[model samples]
Target: MAISASVSLVMTLAFLLASCGGMGTHRGTPLELTIAHINDHHSHLEALPDQIVRIGGVDTQVELGGFTRLASAFRSYEGRDNVLRLHAGDASTGTLYYTLFKGRADADMMNTICFDAMAVGNHEFDDGDAQLKSFIEQLHTGPCKTPVLSANVHPQRGTPLAPQNAEDYIQPYAIKNIRGIPVGIIGITIKRKTQDSSSPLPSTSFEDETSAAQRTIDQLKARGIRHIVLLTHQGYQADKAMATKLSDVDVIIGGDSHTLLGNFSKQRHLPKSAGPYPTRVANRDGKPVCVGQAWEFSKAMGEMNVSFNAEGDVTSCTGQASLIIGDRFKRKDAAGKWVAVDPATPQKIAAEAATDASLKMLAEDAIASNVLRSYSSQTEKMQKESIGEASQALCLVRTPGESFNASGEVAGCEEANQRAHGSDVTQLVAQSFLRTSLRADLALHNAGGVRIPVPAGAITLGQAFALMPFNNVLIELPVTGEQIIAVLEDAVSSYLDAGRSSGGGHPYAAGLRWHLDMSQPKGRRFSRLETKDRQSGTWASLDPARTYIVATHEFLARGQGGYASFKPIYDSGNYVNTHFLYTQAFVDYVRAHGKVQRPAPADYSHQAVTTQAGVVLH
Candidate 1:
């Protein structure tokens, strides 16, 4: 009887152990939550580089980053006591994949990866509000269930923030229960008004980021949520400012900046204090905080492991940002021979083991898939397509101090001129169009407007579309010759400042070449300025009183390129879509002359030029 009774007791204890994770004091211990995160995927669905990374002194080989490989990794962590998968933002742009599918394939892939929540990036609005609404509908109605959250965006007067599923579309915050501890997440986006005009953000207003975050944090605290994570589309400096100002925030998983934080040491800037304050401040409950972010694309995943006490306060934390390199990749060495290798463990491993067959198959599939073939295939299928031709092979490369007039000079012209524009490829195209269409004295376009390099080959209609993606119209403005000189001086100053120049040493211009003094303040860079008339073929001194017709893109004419002085230059009636004109010109030129000759530099005389205190050039 005693032996039988003991067996029954043992059976009952075993049942309890299996049901409640093995009894004792372990039941009350705070759960360990592991969060795996990535941000700014930007439609890179292919497997990235796989490398062995060192995290907290532990070397672990991360082999893949495709949605499938990420799926496998998620499955491995499934059934763990606590785990969450998340992405920061900016998953909607940057590649042929995004351009083709308009974020459908990306949504499907992200759904497969099982993302719990995502912040809306500025690019999410690139296709306009209606498309963004459709994307939201697909996410909500699709097989995968996840919430797209943005706290600051408020719809303009008539447009709805979200017409369908308006109730469940977005929330200021979400609370997740992990082992009896509640984790609160707050989502915010950068103010769209401050963004570049190229971004297709709706006319809706976005609240100030810092204020919005503080209000949300206060609300979360009111609900008794102690642990907070801010999922923000604001850039790195903004995130740091939020972290320092708001002590309630526990961890900031941010995007938009595309910053890579590989380890905790790389995140030394966190726990920063505000202003003159030295010591790190604490939340209302008094807890230290951490901030982290992953670089853009599927190139990496960020992992942060934090231990909290019974009070739901973080005690210790370790972070690792793992880079995802594709498998079976062969890199050339100094001798230029392809060799089998492991980037992490370079010494010894089987050649077969080094190659990941699955990843290789994926790369092959991406290349073979029709979706990846051209960036416009899917886009054209969705909208009414138009056919156009290119007259000139629009080349996108620009050399420093090069101007648009170089094209005319290259075609052979003398030093006689009446306007000042620099030599650059885009400037050349703009100048050619101005002279051919409107007979303008000077032509101008913002350096930022020219996006990609127009490859010297068969210029497809789609290629032209991509080159001038932004639908901006051309406008002719009337400005004094002095104002034109001022604009040229600004461009020259930008050329000398390594940080300000967009195309490295290259600063775009249309008419003239003048020496710049790097040592002086920006406005004083020009030491010599001269121009030549196109028809007269004789050199002329610039008449400060003469009103010159300047052709420029609409954005610059509106004073966007830091050229506030140009705002006073009123626009003339000869306005046309710059893209349309360029397309027509390119098509005509290409059709007429099978080959487009490259523009060469012009020889112009500038007398002795010198800067303040005798910094001279001849």
Candidate 2:
């Protein structure tokens, strides 16, 4: 009986690792490797609408980072030898590009640059194993094949990723014969976070990332592969720790935290960098090990130059991560349509009035031309298709609350209008749910769930989806009025204790109103709680003991992101999905009420402070 091909592939790699004891023959040459990497791209195929950059000390709007600039960066390294391009993880989710086309649009773009090797991101499992398997196949449809890797992943028996199809795509490590010297690239992904956050099946399992890296590094070294690079999605801080944990790993190219590295002080107006490029950490043996992360959303590309001694130990590491941006392109308004750059600005890259014309000229190469263009052409048309209209701009505002301080006394709010009020976006989404679900007494939604503002204009399907990108379903659950109050308290109290950045965990809701007093104790801040009277459309005090059916998204119902108060409700099995996509519900609700108008400006909450001492959020 002959052994299977899958068996052979697995056994051969294992045998190569298992049987080897000593260093193999060739000492060859002092190797130089240039690795270009990006992670958490989130299917941002083009320059994102919200990317802001400072030009000539002027807060200028420009196209900053897209596939075009990344393509140019890769092309710049053409004549260099032993060069490899890597994407750490998360090549999915976030935009209409992924929503309409799914991973196909992302796969088409990946094939454009054809990364040498990529780690499996948690978002890759958003559609489950079958989709990830399909994406792997699609990614290889190019002149050269790009290997996908994830060393910590172990799919249980009877799963799609079980031995049957797994061997064809995912690999533990890839050995590249660079400059006659073997360089091993190992992949590691976030373990528990992947299981908790995404849609991976129950049978699939993840090992500890540090432990997995050590095992893989040992195997690679056993086979006499010297220069090992750990390509990971475990985030920046963990990458720093892994340097001390893994002895043989010379460099860690990382992702998942979306951490920006390198100096950005020169580039004012950009978000501050997390640390220096290739943030150096000492290994267990006290040897220098370098780590780098390109900022997320393909806004930047990581460039690292590493030199190794003849013995395979790294001698020196250098190079900085750079932002990818364009000098010329159209700008977008808050509502996210392609609009011309401001005419009043002193400097304009292109003098012509930006028209509703082809942006296909931005496509600089074959990948953008043959692949991205086709998808762009269709989606662009769909983006312009009118869904409905809004009467006025529903601005996404974030204002620090009066009493919310790092010391945990004040319960601050993230957003406000003329009054220290809550966000309109959150309130609008909550209201839409109530309109669609008639039985609900209250509607609640997270402020972050709505990514963008709804500009007062013709709303398009593109804009609607952008505002709500998560695939959360509308869900309704039964809870006492007391529980609802506790939820609101928990939303603010937890963030205040942690001094959370963007700590605006304050929830917004419709069919309800409440007053928040910063001077009061944490749990006692909310007062004058009221619910809408369905009969008269007037406010009525909420009775603490009375039960009410509340509408919220599946994300909230699942008790995720500091919503553990809802976990008991989730465990009660009383909650049920309304079988409507939350984002689509907004569209349906808006269409049902022709010409959607901003809800009347009314204070949902009030804030007051007694202390004269200045409070600043840590």
Candidate 3:
């Protein structure tokens, strides 16, 4: 919460007051609107765990982000004119709070906070359409039903969503009064991501993103709604691109990609910047459009001031992406230098040192605190209950392949040789998926899903949830040998060209084996590609004509996370949803095999064919 530059405490109030006839008619002077936004809350209802941040280039741990701080930050603008509170979605999944309560806790919190409207994020459909509808229906059960919007999603006729849409629970756009002005807020979720990567029902379909947005804008403008805000679940870059294309959108409050949009140069405690706050881009008519998005996990809240002229064009806009961090630990001296304390220092000063952290948790907003305590107490209890026990520490890491990242991760052959070929945890999870697969030839897993590393101790439900947090379903897609090889190459493409693919689609598998040469061309990197025979469990060379049932999660099976080769099956509706959660498979695997020990290190079946590169690194 270090402010490199001083921002007005009464910024929202100032904008509101100035909007209410500071001089003359609205036509003569610009009409002002204040938008307070949050996105990617991810069910982090209570205060987040203490995290380390670079403060003035020094690592410092501070307790940051919670529902209370967000509420407190917005409380200042209560009852103010020309002000709207909007959320850009992703208010689901992350912690034990979501695991125990589904989205009820999040609904309750957002119900109380009472956003004017919210976009439908991709993760909202993680539990399927019915659960998402149920979660939305649970919101406070009062007049304060937040407008849930997604213009591109068109639920088929006779579907639950279609009927509800006719009932007004889901709509393309909403018009709210900002002071006396009617401002149209259109919400759009990323169509492709939600369609392919999430668990939306089969009947739920998506239209082109750019088309949906423009159509909605035309519809709104036809109704004489000029001041428009697009609350979008699209990433920051997409928003910028939309700004350049759209003719009517005055402001965009965006989410997804969990991007931080602001100047963090002076604010050491805040996240690094992706771009400037209110990233300005010209619309189709070459007029400026303002785009603003807060960072993820409720760590920050965005305040954007937009002034519109009589023609409904933006005159001026300012966005403050403020990190809602609590006051904790100590600060540097007046000269801005961190002073190290000596062992012989006086008792009083030493007691007040950063090491002591004398000032524990900072004060939180009363209303937010009350709500958080109610649900947090139950979640905490659920988090502590033991789920299983590990025989030994199973080291969990995202990347286990070292040679694939030689430039960054490997200093020499020794370093590359020392790294594990594959993560025991991911491979274990893949094996679990295979065990649960009805009759798949093999099972595959992406490294990104393996979140928290397991320590040697009793594994709790919370720990397991943390490990595989996403509510991804198990799916087995039918693919030909060539398609499988294409995706395998796609998975390793990032490794082949690290500059283009930092997180190359690394795959961990069970009932399958392959040797890869990183130095070869992207498509030719893999060799000895094999899958286990379902009946005899014998590794056999992939047959080009054979139709293999490849077990994978919904995300990857839909060709997300760099596995575009599987997308053909998904697009053609040739995959089967095993109706099992990904984590449950791992849980079953652990329970079946009691007291799992630290796995023996295994060598990579694949490595860079150094000679193929025609060069040598010292």
Candidate 4:
């Protein structure tokens, strides 16, 4: 009996990697391989709102990054030979797509692209091993049969990932054939981060990253696979560091820090790149290792073309990370609102996109779009359910007195920033966190986490999701009042120095207040710090020696976004994972209150602000 085409396709890339041996090949056969990859899609299946990017030397707005657009981009490389389509990880747990449908929606969208392999990101364990197992099952239902790879992870017997003594649910590596050249792609998840921060099974354990990786590499080399690629979920910096520690690691595609790498000198409006695309570093043997990462939220895809000699050593690697965007154009109107531009604007933009190496203009792939449409309809129906109402328009501002969305999304937002208090929405979110966790004395929130302003009208589940878009859970940390002051200083000094996003690092809190003097040095920048007693509702000066429980999201608690003081405390095993979803906390708060309004002036986190230029807003 003859094998069908589908069966042949599956057989061509041998999945029986453990038992495979070397095959005869031409010694001098040079190869050019193109790797198409994405990371940290985080269930953002739909297109994001209008984003401002530099187009034609002007800031132009366009919709960016959807799975449908990614599907189209990946399909564009079909005609090319020796191509590998990969996803680094964190494909689930962010938007309503993951919350309502779980991993099924993410699986459906991923099946559209049919990735060759995917790494195991820490967020995959957010709901435990059973949910991840279910997701992997859905991913396997399609013809791709993409292998889930994580070298260091070991599931104990009877765990969901290792049920009934089965060990094939997640493999250490996968073998792929590129034009008769057998290559090994290994997966390495961040070890300690997953165990400490995420909800993995207690019995399941992860090995030290460097040791496990080297063991896997040696095994592949023994099987005569020389071209090695590591699909890792560790942060970009960690990936670069790990590259130097290992041998035979020719290329690394990574995720988890959401670090954007590549030069965007022409596209000045895009977020700054952390490093050059394909950042080259020397391996242990002084050989080269190329590292690349696409930005978060499906905004970009990385294409790295590696040229190899007969020995399978990478001679050169080059490519660009292109921002996937739609042709539809929008620009700020006279009223400062984002509105559709003239029809000719898109054509002109598309013309420029043709020449721009960093931008790729594309429309949603029809098949992927159709697949998303069914789930999107369900999402829409559920999101429309009313939760509560806002008594007034709560302006969205990152920093007090900074003109962000003043006349645009929220009318009269200009007046909202006239005072020293920062974002009303952010403070409200902090209050929700504190309220949800009764053990905490204060709630701290990053301004960037809260996405949109609250209009003075009905608030729906969709609006709540829009408010807190990340999959961050609430955690309580016990720290001295002194550490609280220092953490706030760290947050302010991070962006105050320059060349950073100020709004995202700005801190907002409930049951706490502070007077900030931006003109002062880092430690001296904050003064008049006070804490409110929950029972008496009386404010008193924060005692630097006193221990206090602080409520914050997992991101900040992990020392991200310049909250350096929180990490050590969290690592000390003195912290509590409340396991309360942030968005759900807001929903619960709204349901309990029936309506929401801005906190009183005395309760605002930012009691006063003295700008760097000596202007005070009070």
Q: Kindly give the number of clashing pairs for every candidate.
A: 35, 4, 3, 0
Q: 374-409, model 2: which lDDT tens digit per residue?
A: 888888987787878878666554323432111111
Q: Per-residue alpha-carbon lDDT of model 1 for 231-320, expressed as tens digits?
A: 888766567667777757777778876665543332221212122111123544457666667665676676777777766666766656
TM-score, structure 3 vs. true: 0.74
Candidate 2 backbone overlaps, count: 4
Which is the winner by TM-score between candidate 1 and candidate 4? 4
Model 3: worst 10 consecutive residues (lDDT sum):
405-414
TM-scores across all candidates? 0.63, 0.77, 0.74, 0.76
541-593 in candidate 4: lDDT tens per residue?
99999999999998889876667788899888788998888999999998899
Report the lDDT of model 4 for residue 460.
Answer: 90
Which candidate number maximizes TM-score? 2
Model 2 lDDT-worst window of ten = 352-361
Which residue pairs in candidate 2 collide? 399-414, 399-415, 403-410, 404-410
User: Which pairs of residues clash in candidate 4, taking residues 3 or more apart in a chain or in different chains?
Assistant: none
Q: Which ten residues in a row have the lowest lDDT in candidate 4?
A: 403-412
lDDT of 1 at 124: 76
TM-score of 1: 0.63
Please give the CA lDDT of all the candidate structures: 0.54, 0.72, 0.72, 0.84
Runs of candidate 4 with Cα error greater than 4 angstroms are 1-20, 24-26, 332-339, 343-345, 384-426, 435-460, 466-509, 513-529, 534-537, 542-582, 588-618
Model 1 Cα shift for residue 40 (angstroms): 2.5
Q: Give the higher-lDDT candidate: 1 or 4.
A: 4
* Candidate with better lDDT, 2 vs 4: 4
